[model samples]
Target: MLISFGEHAKVVRLEILSKIGEGLQDRESGDRNTD
Candidate 1:
């Protein structure tokens, strides 16, 4: 159970990081983030 929770948290963190990176990239490229 503890391992499953850790895995879930890792996945969520990865998703969040990807989103932030994408937002930054869009901003740098002067594209519409639209969020």
Candidate 2:
């Protein structure tokens, strides 16, 4: 049970990181478009 919980946490962390990365990329592209 503990192992499963740990794995779940890792997955959630990875998802959050990916989402943040995508957001940064979107902002960067938006800035380029404005210029």
Give the candidate number with the greatest lDDT: 2
Supply candidate 1's per-residue lDDT for 12.
95
Residue-level lDDT tens digits of model 2 in 1-35:
35688899999999999999999999999999999
Q: Report the lDDT tens digits of candidate 1 across residue range 1-35.
A: 35688899999999999999999997977755453
Clashing pairs in 2: none
TM-score against native, each model: 0.74, 0.84
Best by TM-score: 2
Taken over the whole model, the C-alpha lDDT of each candidate is: 0.86, 0.95
Q: What local lDDT score does residue 35 receive in model 1, on the 0 to 100 scale?
A: 33
Tell me the deviation in Å of residue 26 in model 2. 0.2
